[model samples]
Target chain A: MKNIIQNKSKDLQNEIDNYLKCITDSSLLFFEGAREAYRGDYDDAENRYRDISELERRADEHLKAIQYKLYAYNIAPDSRADIFELLDGLDDIVDRAKKNIFQICVEKPVIPDCMKDDFIAITAASVDAVDILIQGVRSFFEDVNSLEGYIKNVYLYEKKADALEEKIKRSIFQSTVVEELARKFQLRYYVEKIAMLSDLAENLAKKMLMYKIKRII
Target chain B: MILKLFYLSSGLFMGWSLGANDAANIFGTAVGTKMVRFTTAAIISGVFILLGALLSGAGTTGTLGALGAIKALPGAFIVSLTAALTIMSMTKAGLPVSTSQAIVGSILGWNFFAGATTDYTVLYRIAGAWLFTPILAALFSVGLYFLFKAILENIKIHLFSLDWIIKLSLILAGAFGAYSLGMNNIANVVGVFMSVSPFVDIQVGDYFVLSSLQQLLFFGGASIAIGVITYSKNVMMTIGSGIYRLSPVTALIVVLSSSLVLFLFASENLQAGLIALGLPAIPLVPVSQSQGVVGAISGIGIAKGGGNINTRLLGKIVVGWLLTPLCAGILSYISLFIMQNVFLQKVFI
Candidate 1:
């Protein structure tokens, strides 16, 4: 409420917005890499992963700046830790995006023609989950009452991503038509990693809710 | 003229402390929120306070004069100095202090020393004002909040424009609050000096002239301006964020309500009107601006939801409020005794 406190929050909010933009870009880049991998374009997938790594590094820089500012600024007790916790959790979403995309580029596993759509679908769902999460995070600072609705949408997309992961993993293991056992396991791992990104987003939403409670109550 | 000015020093000091401390209530939120610069607030407040002191500071001094008279020059000096010292000490200790109560206590001490009978009815009325001023101000704020909230909801104003409006409104209300503060509480600063004023009517070019009381108010106003320029920021920060987080709208309401209470109590015509209409007169009492602001803020907190307030800090302030008069009274009494015996000064007429 105080002007001095709000002035401090302005720089902090700017830092958060920068980090969040990078996270959003990384999520979209992760989805693009998954599509290239499904098309048997390893070179394109590698380029996208490199792009995601750059975004991740930029997001990390912003996160560091924010942490430093929080240390420097004599912020309000209600907002200081709660906002940092929210930023930390959001930053991890970018980390997961980077890690998931890198795994796809490195493994270069064989994908069945039939399973390609499902892989792309899982990637789409994961990115959607993070986008909804971005909106939920924005709502935390703006309209707190609207955050629950965005989080519910995040959970819905997460569940869809999980169901697809389970279905695809089971088919890869069961069919005798699949040749290498090691390759089969790797396929499951890659699919599971994509699903993990959504899970991380879901986790962030819940942790954000926790921090919001700690702040107001 | 020099002796008259020297005698006015104590009142000037009390005025300085009042500006340093009470300016927080009027402009703290605006300054702390960074919505207004401290210099901007100080300038607006100082000019308006000077205007209000010149125009409206006389009436309240009449009631204070009735209480103990403090008719001798030495007694007035000692009483005002004791009140000023009490405020400074409490402020340094990081406790909320009231200029009004300290002045009353010092006057009471002087009353005892000068062998004047205390006017019990005037004292009771002042005591009554202290009891009800904050409560009444809080009610005014609560009612104003809901009414303003409803009116604001209907206007689909842009956020930027709304921010500008609120900023302008806060400055305007702060200026109004400054005027009301000068009008009501200036008496607390210089009321005792009125009794022993040395200047008679003076004429310069037959058109421009000044009374002794006018000189006192002018000197008092200048001291408060100096306090605002030099010392208000720390107190403003404390009251702005320390009490609770006040929004722009909430800050405006709190200030308006505080001014409302001061104005209501300060107006004799309004009091007489109420009495004529079969209603009890609201006692004309000098109130602490901080107390009124705190009460309004807490009132809004209750109106919204009730659980987040810091009860311990509030408890300390409550204790300080209760002890303010007692401390000032004892300090004044002892100081007056020492001035009479140790300094071998004439303290009473």
Candidate 2:
């Protein structure tokens, strides 16, 4: 029985590791795609978008498998629902990353040189927030006590993303270089889309904090 | 032959009730939290309970015998019947009840009816053990709680591995709890009938022997096992979710601590070992598993900073401790009178 339980746990852990890897890979892909788009490398950004889309599909498959195994193996019956919610929240991070990159690929907005650095900064901040959130989720499974520190980092990166997002929007509208209102709105839309990743991460961090409290023995 | 079986049925009925109610104390949290399936818990608890009764049930039975030896079969039957009735009535009224306390009270009533002198020393020992059972369990749980907490904090085990550990621990603890329950409370089921038991000792060649007392306990244990198989699921559910929502880890600790308390009071080998070590021997007496569980939970509450300790529930348990025996004693005396006079049966010799 012990061996059976250990094997089940190992199997579930492997699946979780795979799923988390997909999310982490998507975040990296998102950062690269956003940087490429701002650099006017439309073909490279489009390729990154395709890679992230595949990862999103794989993550969905992993999520379904994980949900099945959790019920089948009857692991942590009391916390199963919370675990499902946490996994769904994580999957959403990758999903949001995919959608944002897809939008950037299709819209192909011409980046003004003055706002390009800020766009890259916002993407880096959002990706960093997501990276820390992934670590927090891993810590939730491995060492819940260490999870609080990771969650704090996620929040910090999210705050940076928020500040950078506001700065980029203010600059796009205030600068005399981009005169068209429609072009400014397009830039603002891209900024919010990228910043939304950090928003999702922040919300997930709050939920993870509550889940951690419930997990305390 | 049939008449003897008829009289023994009351004791079997008592055993059934014990299994129905007390098995919950052992496996309730595990089943309630869905950590273990009901079928698995029942099978494990049933087998261990019978094994414990067959192997080690004599110690606590000796203590009960010393309390009041019901010399007549009819008297023993009446005592068991009245005790079982008391438990049923009290449980129906939503009052706390213990088979150990009820049986002792019924035996005292038998003594009164038979004009026999009650052994106050033995009575005091039994009563003292009853009072100490929960406190001992409480102390054990508190110590175990800290130990487990420290180990978990230091180890930082993964959630999946921890869940596996808790599930396995709950099963092991439930088995131990079932064994201890059988060892201690089998006395309450058949102890009174030991003096009048009809079974003869059997020897198979030179290797195996089964005494009449062992035969009696075997039957009593079977009845308890049957009760577990048939009626314990709902009780387990109620105990698991209704009475203080215990996490799987806390449930393991509670079962372990309570089982240790029951084993201390029931294991003759442990008692002998203590005496051999020049320490005072632990008394072999039937103690309530319900009391042990309650005490363990209270210990946990205290360990968690004393909030959520229900003093009103504690007060009600105390009232139950006092009231169960008194009610059983009165019922036993009246029932014994009716059996002797109205049924024209000899209740005493």
Candidate 3:
């Protein structure tokens, strides 16, 4: 019976890992789509953002599953609350990112000379952090040893996201025309969404670390 | 036995008012700030007040017993009932006043009516404490405001950087306020009963009891706690609406600050640490929770801009605080005079 319970929780963890992988892949596709849109490939960017939104929906379902289990078991009320809150925060990030892409498609923004590198860095960092998050939760559940290094990497990724958001904000301020400024603002908002995605990933990794500390998982 | 029952019932009523009104002081700021819903705030304050009373109510009972010559069971009952009624009536009028002042005033009235001389030194200390409460509170509020702001700004560090820190601070601060409220204010709810328990009696001469003072205090604390949980909601609502709005963080700060001051005053003996600092010995004067928090709020309002401080609300509070003792004293005097002249005389006749 104990083994059955353990296996069920492990299965849930695996589901989370799978969803996270989809998130990373969708993120990459969205970034590429964004690049294409910047280069006037509007249809492809729209498709990429649509795919990312669908991935976000899947992630949302996994989060709901985790929440439902936490509520069912009544294990640690505080921990459960934190997890649910973090999930909502994660969903918010994806929602914002998708919304920004749709707006960008509507505008057909003239890409700035400086913002291209910042936007690329934002996408790369966001994707990498999600990758790190999936690995952290997976290895932590599978074996405690796998999480030690990955958790630190998750922090590094979050910092990278923060840096990217800052760069994007600075680029937005430097844009001259109102239209360009507005487009820069949209890009900055998208970058911030991606940055918060890293924060959510970092939070999950921390939760996994705590569960291991208490030997509760 | 019937007379004792009357006082016991009154004590419970007082407790309920204390729970409803004073508990708000502990939690109002938090509720006002929208940190915790009103229902959650009420529950947290109510449960913890009871817990604190059950755990450390003895010291407060002792303070009440030592405050005056409340020896005879009958006299004790009268005093308790008088104080309780005074508190209830005052509370009903939308006044966020202290039951502490009401009790002290009623006790003095009881002494005058009985024509008994207790100790002058005790009375003097109490009166002095009462006089100094507002001044001390004002000073503390102004000083603590700047002090905390300085720490928050100058430290250049956030204490809540980690998630666990946020969770821990909330729980710790809430529990501390509840505990301190229980410790200091339990006596206000049940103190008169301590002197008039079956085991003790007022001899009109000394602070002697017929039985164990501790037992009576415990009963008073327990009964008052019950009252607060059951019927304090109306008073709580009155406070929430009447006083400045409270957010959860502000409520937490208010409760913590008031509870800390109350605990210091109620301690059995001054701590060596506090004494070494050359701070004056804190007298066991039951400070009003309303006064403590209002003072804090006024400090906050001043810091923001004194114009933001609602003069109308401030006026109401000031009127209530001034009138509580006077009204309680006069009402008790009239009630006791009637009891002694009309009712008691007829019964004896």
Candidate 4:
């Protein structure tokens, strides 16, 4: 029974790592699609976003599977709580991405407008943050030494995303045209999604750190 | 004492209705400005109100009994319940009216039913209080706007830094308003019943303390808190977007000023304070919550070059203020008469 519990814990960690990796890849691809839309490569952008959305859906499915496994194993209440929050956060990011893509496909506002560059920068920074989040969680889960640097780096990236978003909002308000207004509103939504995604990643990293302290991970 | 039980139960219902309907007055601007999300605003408002009621809401619990014309505990209970039912029905019909006036009107109806013992002087004072609450709210809004403008000019700080500071201030102000609502208005919603009946005796070591009134205020507040969180989104949305444009500073100032007015008037000696301040003897009843908010908004409007005030909306709200009590009194009186003649006389009596 002890050996089985240990093995199940190891499997849970592996599943988490794979989920973060997939999220990072799709996030980068999503940003690339956003950049393409700015460059007037509408077809390429649409295709890339569609691809990212499909991957995000699969990632969510895997996350749900892991949650089911954890429940089946009668995971400690705290560990179960952490998993639920992490999965929910992960799913929220993907859902935001999917929604943004839908808005792009349907609304099709003029590309590379006032908010375009800021949106790209925020998403790129968010992707970087989520990448470090995976590393931080992995280190903490494995009881690897020197996890502070990874955690601090994730905080720094999230802060950077926040600053970028602020600057973008200020610029959007400065412009007065109707088209600029539409672009600004859309850009704000996407930037907020990226920031929120990073925030969730940070929460997961914190939970991992706590789990390590409790020796539950 | 037995009659007081019905009064207490009715007051609890009134409190629930008050929380459900009037919370929007405190939270609408913040939610409308997108300063805070509606869900966060509601939850925070709910939790804080529970805290406020449990702690500081005692002052306003017996406000109507002290402020209005209801003759006895049974009369007060009937008045409160009738007013509450009228307000709820009106709310369902999409007219956002005042719970304060409803309670006052229902008490007046009860007085009329029992004959001329209702204090006309107190009723007049209460009417005057309604008239003044909005005016004071507007004055405070205007005053705060001027004060803010002078400070901004004198400070000579970076605009970006100022924006961040103002946003933070708005958040804090919204939270404070939530707390104050819990402390002050939560009583308006549930306090009547607290004074009406008795609760189970609670044992403290060797001594047993008996409550003369039901402790249903807590439950009523909870119910209203739930209603506000669940159904108040639409009202907040309507007010937030449709009302006048407000800068972050202006919004914060208006809320702060209005909340202060509510807090001050909601004091234990609010009646005496009004007299001391040489304000007309406003009956200490729950006046119109919407009126106070409108007055504050208008104050901000006057401060921000006067174009921001939507006169049409203000007029409509005033109409609601006028109609709510009269309708409650007439409807409740008729309903009570029917119940007395056809229902209660045949059943309980």
Candidate 5:
């Protein structure tokens, strides 16, 4: 009976590790895809978008499997709901990453050379926020005390993303880099969409803190 | 033979109530948190409790014998019956009661009625043990809580692996707690009948033998096991989830600490070892398992910075501690009087 529970727990742990890996893979893909779009490499950007979309699908499947096993095996019965919520929050990071990359591929916004670096910078910050958030989640499971540092880094990256996003929007609308007002609005929408990833990460970090507190015996 | 069985019924009833109520103190949090299944807890606790009773129940029973030594079967019956009745009534009134305390009071009543001198030294030792049980449990828990915390912080175990460890630990601790309960509290259920026990010694093999006292303990232990199997689930749930919500890890500490405390008081070998070392031996007397659990919980609460101590509940338990024995003693005295006079029974000889 003990071996059975240990084996089941090991299997569940592998599934969760795979799920988190999918999110990390998607974040890397998003970073690459946004860079491709900025560089006018539309083919590469499209391929990255397709890969992230597939990863998102796989992550969803993993989430479903994890949920089923959690209930079926009755692991951590007291913290089941909290565990599910934390995992669901992580899935959102990948979901947002997929949508961001897909939007970049479809809209094909023309970027000025001057503001291109700023846009990539925002993407990098958002990706950093998400990467740190994943690390925070892992720390939550392994070492709760170390999780606080990861959470703090996530907040820092999110703040950096927010600032870079503001800088880019201010440059786009205030400077005469783009002549069309509608194009500026489109660029700003994309900026906000990318920045939303960091915002999602920040929210999840707050929740992870609460979960950590509860998990502490 | 029928009359002898009839006289044993009250002791069986006391054992049943002990099983129903005290099993929760061992397995409540584990089952309540769903870390362990109720059936699993019941089986492990029942088996271990019976084994402990059969093997080590003589120590505390000896102490009770020293206290009063009821010589007649009918007298033992009345004492056990009054103790059981007092426990049931106190439980129904939702007061925290201890079978150990009740049985002691009942024995004292018997001592008074039979004109047998109460052994004041033995009585003081029993009272001292009751006071020490919870405090010792609390001290053990506080130390264990910090130790576990330090180990967890230093180790790099995965959350799932940690969960598995805690689940397994709870089971092991519950078993130890059940064993200690049987060794310590079985006396409360059947100790009064030791002088009047009907079983005779039996040799099963050239090397294996069972004494009459062992057989008596086995019967009492079986009654407790039946109570655990049949009626302890609701009480387990109430203790597990209702009183104070303990995390699985904290629950493990609580069980281990309380079990150690009970084992300390009940183990004759340990007492002998201490005596050999020229140290004072802990009295082998039954103590409240519920109080031990409560103390362990409080120790953890204090370890966590002492925010929610629930002093009101502690006050009520203290009140119950005082009132239960008094009620049992009074009831035992009255019941013995009627048994001797109206029923024409020889309560004492």
Candidate 6:
């Protein structure tokens, strides 16, 4: 019984372990780059963007390895396709985070005084959404019954991030903080970038739910 | 050794044709889909079939023996040659056929030529088995599929492990299927030689003995193995890339169920059990593996909700079922006539 348990959980464990590493790694690297940019350390932020690129590449490689191994090892064909698709969707989150950090570094978009806390808040909420999604993914493998709670949290933070994105956009357009429409558009683009991060997390959570249903059926 | 071999070569030829065609039934899906190489499949099947024929290809009487025995070596050779030719023709025509049916028909034709009595009771029983093989195969496959599906769904096994498990199951089932095919069908290949066997009991050790029938089966098995190694690739390639997209698991289930029916039909213990229960014993018949496989496949198709069932394929198979015995019988009769009238040989003792 113990041996069977170990074998059954082994693949799920690998999925969770690898997925969490990419999620955590991309999230941390992106945030660190954002912090350095906020502190006017463009060189450091640029370096971090390079790191995020490196991380995303590594994550993709890791995901491909897991995909091949899982397929080769013994997952049922029906389940195999779903897992590959799920991981593919999850990998999107890291890709988006890497792109967002790269956008900030290239544009060197100036952070205005009034929207500083809001930008930070937006980043935190996106991170939280992803964090919840990661947990949901973990709980799904650990105790599938308990996955709903983490999934709910993922949705909750996604909605929260969406609202924060709306507030930041409104403040940028309505307030005379920078005076140029182009500059305001730049701010909106960066704000939407952060919101899209949570969007990706929410998309991943939905895919996870899909895979769960597939498992059940 | 050489003269004896020449006499029984026809039987070995029939065995070769059987292995060439039936190799598709056991290893088609795996080889077709490129999961396993044709060479690998052939080698594995060959080894298992040889083992199966040597070990359990015993006591193949009751039905074929009752039909009529070719008591003369020349008559047995003629019958085997006729059967082998029929099978070769069918395979050449791209039809998967039952070598068992061919052998039976040939034996009956020889019975006619030799002026021996063909027992209707034995013919009726063999006919009945051929009739029910597909039905029984379908039923067994449906039952086993549901049982396996239930267990898998309940366990909700991780996907990777599930794949691993299915592949392993397929290998085991395929091996067993090949073994069972050899065990049950070896009779068709060499059963005609039983009465004509000149060899005495082969004493191996103080406790072991190889009978004449077993010795004939071993040679027949080697020819079958040779057929697998040399041929089987063309059929595999044709079927693999064809319209049939059956999963490995489905293939495994079908093979398992078909082999089970074949094994059950061949089992002396099971026949004895039936007799003990005061029921008619299952005839030790050389049942059609092709029919059994078709039946199992149909059963799975039905169980999987019936929409995917290929009506055209089923119809073709049903037609072939009717055609197989008739073609074999007529060919055997004509061949026997030529051998008797033209060659002027005594076909009976």
Q: What is the DockQ of candidate 5?
A: 0.58
Docking class of 2: medium
Question: Across residues B1-349, which tens digit of lDDT does each residue of candidate 4 receive?
Answer: 5644554666666665666656666667666756556777787778766765555566555665564433344545566678888887877765657777777677666556655466666667667667787888898888887888677545544322343455456556666766666666665565444444346655657775434322454665576677677677877767766653454566677778877766665555665777899986433344566667778888877876888787876776777767888888887677667766765531111
Model 6 regions lying over 4 Å from their true place:
A1-16, A28-54, A60-92, A110-179, A191-217, B1-4, B31-40, B92-94, B205-207, B233-243, B277-280, B343-349
Please name the candidate that would achieve the greatest DockQ relative to the true structure. Answer: 2
Ranking by lDDT: 2, 5, 1, 6, 4, 3
Q: Candidate 1 lDDT, tens digit per residue, B1-349? A: 6866777778888888788878888999888876677888898888887777777777677778888877667778888898888888887886767788899998888888777899999998887787667677778888887877676655554322345567778888988999888878888888887878766767778698888788777777778777777889997877667655577788889999988888877767788899999998777677777777766776676666656444565575577667777788888898889988997777777
**Candidate 5, A83-189: lDDT as tens digits:** 89999988988888888888888889999999988998999999999999999988888777788999999999999999999899999899998989999999999
Single-chain TM-score of chain A, each candidate:
0.92, 0.96, 0.71, 0.78, 0.96, 0.90
**lDDT of candidates 1 onward, in order:** 0.79, 0.91, 0.62, 0.65, 0.90, 0.77
**Model 3, span B39-110: residue lDDT tens:** 655566666776666666666566666766566555555566777787778767867667887887777777
Provide the lowest-lDDT 10-residue window in model 4 chain A: A1-10
Evaluation by DockQ, superior candidate among 1 and 6: 6
C-alpha RMSD between model 4 and the true structure: 16.7
Misplaced by over 4 Å in model 4 are: A1-217, B1-13, B67-77, B89-96, B156-164, B186-188, B191-195, B198-201, B205-214, B269-284, B345-349
Best by lDDT: 2
- lDDT per residue for candidate 2 within A1-217, as digits (tens), equals 4432454878899999999999999999999988998898989999999999999999999999999999899898878899989999999899899899888889899889988888899999999999999999999999887899999999999999999998988898888878999999998999998999999999999999999888665
A132-194 per-residue lDDT for model 3 (tens digits): 766665554344445679988988988898887886777577656325555656666666765
Tens-digit lDDT track for model 5 on B1-349?
Answer: 7899899999999998899989988999988888888899899989999988988999999999889989899999999999999998998887878899999999988988899999999999998988888788889999999999999878888887788778888888888999999999999977999999977799998997888898899999999998998999998898777875788888899999989999999999999999999999889999999888888887887888888676776787789878988999999999999999999999999
Q: DockQ-based ranking, best first? A: 2, 5, 6, 1, 3, 4
Instruction: Give the winner by TM-score.
Output: 2
lDDT of 6 by residue, B163-229 (tens): 5566666667778888888878888888888888757779998998988877777887887888777
**What is the TM-score, restricted to chain A, for candidate 5?**
0.96
lDDT of 6 at B174: 70
Docking class of 1: incorrect
Looking at model 2 chain B, report the run of 10 residues with the lowest lDDT sum.
Answer: B308-317
